[model samples]
Target: MTGSREALPDVDGSGLTLGDRAAIALTEYRNGNHQALGELVREATPLLWHTVRAQGVEHDAAEDVVQSTWVALVRHAETIAEPKAVLKWLLVTAKRAAWEAVRKHRDDEKRRTELPDDSPEHPTSLPAKDPLPDAQVLSDERDRILWSSLQQLPRRCQELLRLVSLADRPDYRYISAAIGMPMGSIGSTRGRCLAKLRTILDEQGDFSWT
Candidate 1:
């Protein structure tokens, strides 16, 4: 049930997608190998974070949802019915939890707004905030521009691109399922999204993303 925000390990040449590794991790955990679960946590937490964040959950609540998703995986390790689909399971669980959090926040805000204006609990002013803390820290102007351009895309495109960037290309089907996208067309959809992103970047300036 432990996790970290460390960068994903390079699995190039291993012939294993994140989905495959998730299945292996769950199977190993079921067989009393706890280390695999920890490795999965370290590797997959970023994916979970972004998945939750894409649901419009705030940063702090997204952190809680990600951790709870890992905990739920451990609790249901024996009854998941299909270990091969563990990555999709995690993404779905995190997304549902995020939706719940957003719903609860909206309910609370609604209640607050209904309160009397002079109520002690009523805020006097809206709070200012910085950008989301989980946003990638840009190292230069080009990186910043690329990130800005990314934000200009549709939310679905943003979610797809972020998940694919953090995972193996072979896992796109799992990601597509998690994000409610049609599996058969995810490849073409991703290609179109990338082309659109490149077009946006080009409009910004001649900056090499490579």
Candidate 2:
């Protein structure tokens, strides 16, 4: 699924956080409003993909995990006890799925290593190194610089910043649950992350992010 960072909607004035929309979406889906769920998927897929990838799942596996997460949501819609926590549920579910994928991959690698080499060795097929769908959207010089700067931060900071960028409005409660960060520290952590990013950008020379 191709997406442009530039195309992410500005929801600052909407008076509704992504988490809020997620709750409404879940409630609507449970009431048979399937289109609401579809809309939520489009808005939230990027966040889910990043959340999965942050768990160390590879791109292909991350895609599968994200898809399965949505499917899981559908399957458990009626059973979800808190519609308001739907966003956190999705994040946690995707994260667990990603961990399972990583574990399975390690197991497969171990099994391959244990197999006896009775026949001629065959060349291993490497997955194609395709640019990530969202990465492809960073064609603009500023966007490229910003992304590179993000990479320079610590892994947790990178994950936090990416998640914050994807959300309409950062919901610290859900973000904390998703990333295993302290609920009270998310805001300050994000501030420090942004400060570090800005410092990196400043060293690269002044470029307005605003």
Candidate 3:
């Protein structure tokens, strides 16, 4: 993780480049300056953001990839032969993580899609529909449609949505830690996923929320 990394934009300092900050931060971090680690995150995050995004990863997944890259950098920072090349190292790491996330996301989507193809529609819905008032039965039917639509989302979105639902509305920190998602991004990702679900439902025009 060394060689040819350049200075990041918008993180100007006292005539120092982002690469320079990285070197100083690495040394300070190794020398017991925990704050340097924070500086490192601040300095390199934007560069990593664009690096990962350029690979076609969505914003939320890119956030997670970037976070993982930083974690990896912290673990392997000392292995770098050239601390001055830290920015390049970070870009490489983030890009690799983004590619990995994309692959995994696609694989998971394939598996889920295959499952649904082999399984019956209403697999979890309309199973011997419980005897209920007409209104409740229709409600359950609409809810089932919503549930199925949620599954149609990208795997990353499905995972975050499932975790959010399971967490009983606690702080996303728990979900983030459990799933390795970036804590700073859980809310927006959730919002986007839910919006996707609603959009799908709206396109069908069969479910009325009002």
lDDT of 2: 0.78
lDDT, candidate 1, 122-201, per-residue tens: 54322233254344567578878878888888868888998889999888878887688887789999988888999999
**Cα misplacement distance, residue 21 of candidate 2 (Å):** 1.3
Candidate 2: tens digits of C-alpha lDDT, residues 1-210: 012223333435477888877877777787688987899999999999988877777777889999999999999988887777789999889888888898887677656775454233431222333245375678777888887787789979988888887886567678777888887888788889989999999888778878
lDDT for 154 (candidate 1): 88
Number of clashing pairs, model 1?
0
| TM-scores for candidates 1 onward, in order | 0.79, 0.78, 0.47
Model 2 worst lDDT window (10 residues): 1-10
Measured by TM-score, the strongest candidate is 1
RMSD of 3: 14.1
Residue pairs clashing, model 1? none
Order by TM-score, highest first = 1, 2, 3
In Å, residue 160's CA in model 1 sits off its true spot by 1.6
* lDDT of each residue in 55-156, candidate 3, tens digit only: 557667878898888888889867876666565566667767877887777666666665544444533211142123455655776776766687689967
The TM-score of predicted model 2 comes to 0.78
Q: Cα lDDT for residue 204, model 3?
A: 68
Error of 2 at 151 (Å): 2.2
Model 3 misplaced regions, further than 4 Å? 1-13, 114-210
Number of the top lDDT candidate: 1
Give candidate 2 misplaced runs (Cα > 4 Å): 1-13, 114-139
